[model samples]
Target: MPLVLFVDMDYYYAACEELRHPEAVGKPMIVGTGDTAAKMSGVVESCNYEARKLDIRSAMPVAQALRINPDIIYIPADHDYYDRMSGRLMEILKAFGYRMEVISIDEAAVDLDSMSYEQGLVQGKRIKEEIRKTLRLPCTVGIADGKVLAKIVCDSAKPDGLKLVERKDIVQFLSEKSADKIPGVGKKTAEKLEAIGIKTIGDIAKSDLVSLSSAVGSFGFELFQIANGIDESRIVEHYETLSVGRERTLDATKDVQKIYLLLDELSEEVYREITKNGFRFRTVTAKARYSDFTDKIKSKTLGYWTDSPEILKQTAKALIRELIEEKPIRKVGVRVSSLEMGNKQMKLF
Candidate 1:
């Protein structure tokens, strides 16, 4: 049977902070915008395992975390640093040549269909060890026959460890896990499931599909599949998004120049976002919502894929002109679609 392997960096943001100040490796610290004297005024973006020992958690108010440990090391978040490091780490994983899915900034899943269960176990250990040795950052690895089981096992093995759930043990492996153990079951979904007395993975696994579909629509049916270790999702090397866009509802206006200015701003923002996420697109679209709440859209297809703000803005402006006429506009949007994977670099010979 193919093994699905999940890898999650241990307290990723905090770990990155520790790597910068090696003395803090075994010490408690947090990365956020809060200052101790600011009454712990900032939100904790990430906390080291040492801080976690005191029950300090991510998204907790900085002041509350300080109240938990007045001396907790506090540092601001460095997003650029983290993004650069994440890119490098992903490159390393991509080199492994497995079918891969990057689930988060610090988490990924890989399929080892060409290897045996025992081989998967060996490689899982290797990946965990190499990440720590090469990057000096700790991670956890989980190996199982299904993606859902692998992710659950990864959670139980957090902050640096490996866990393997064999194919024969899939049901028993998840029997006691909370319904929220499944990926899509957030707080609200968990509350709904618990209200209906479906409190465990095993409960959902055995629940009636028709009843779940009725209660929660298609999401409920999806949860049923995950609960039963039936997650059929595949591992891709990277995620492919359908669109990148920015839209706004605005004060009614009909001036052509004013509308052009709005299109310029939206185009810049949309293009910036797509560029940051490494996307290029050949289609630019513009939408206008008139005071009457009537909406119209126009699209233009570029001859080639691009991540250029100017190109997008020009195309969107032209398209909007074709759609906007005499109507007092209440909303405008710019969207770039027909995306390509790479963040292409311009070159001149």
Candidate 2:
């Protein structure tokens, strides 16, 4: 049996902030998306364990977090810096020469095909140590026979911890866990299972396939397999880019000129990246996030693909105009999708 290692950075954004400002270590801190001048208006992107203990959470309004802890530290998000750190982390993982899948900016799964469980544990510790020594960031690792199980184990041992679930122990390890503990079992799926008196992984393992299938459709088979400690999920080594985009928070404003200027700037940034990558896009999208956190989006698809900045800017402006009429926007974004490689452009009939 193959073993897979899932690595997840602990409180990634907050950890990155602490790396740069060592004084903030062990303090309740959050990395948020609001402007520095009025951080309370923004949303929490990530928070440290200290903040978690106070019931603060990601996507909670910063104002609500402040209400929870009046003195919690706040750091605005720096996505560019975080991306650089993520690149370095991936490079470190690459050095191990194992087939790896980048799960997210802060998570990855590496295949250790046919490796013994004992050796997998040793490699897990080495990975944890390398990330800590080089990046000064904490991470957790979970080693199991399958990627999903590895990720579940990794999630259970968080904030600088490691665990390995050998094939022999997979059933017992998963038996008592809630069905929701399975990756794809969200609230809706859990509700469906509950309706059929299935509440635990053990229940699913023993469930009648016909009933389980009736409850959740085709996904029921997957749940049944997962509950039985059988996982067929594979590590996808490459993920293609489907879109390019950028967003920024700003002082609350309805000023059309200021909004348009920012939109133009964002469009140019998107244009530069797509052009650099030799992609010509047929769709442009504009997004507006209101002061109260509600958002609206509009998209326009062109009749043909082109790499024209003017069309990108003009289409974005037109789309955003319909959104901004309702309220003062606190943030705006632009995206280009339906992408085709410039070299792959098709001839018109």
> How do the predictions measure up, each by TM-score?
0.71, 0.75
Candidate 1's C-alpha runs over 4 A off are 34-39, 240-340, 343-349
Model 2: lDDT to the true structure: 0.87
Score candidate 1 by TM-score against the native. Answer: 0.71
Candidate 2 versus truth, CA RMSD in Å, comes to 5.2
What do the candidate models score in CA lDDT, each in turn?
0.79, 0.87
Model 2 lDDT per residue over 1-349, tens place: 3589999999999999998877778889989985567687789999999899998999999999999888999898876567568767877998999988877778999999999888999999999999999999999999999999998889888878999998889889989989999998999999999999999999999998899999999999988988888989998764223467788878999998899999999999889877865778998889898887766889988998889999999999999989977679989989887776686425233
Candidate number achieving the greatest lDDT relative to the actual structure: 2
Error of 2 at 164 (Å): 0.5
Candidate 1 lDDT score relative to the true structure = 0.79
Which candidate has the highest TM-score of all?
A: 2
What TM-score quantifies how close candidate 2 is to the native fold? 0.75
Off by over 4 Å in 2: 240-349
Report backbone clashes per prediction: 1, 0
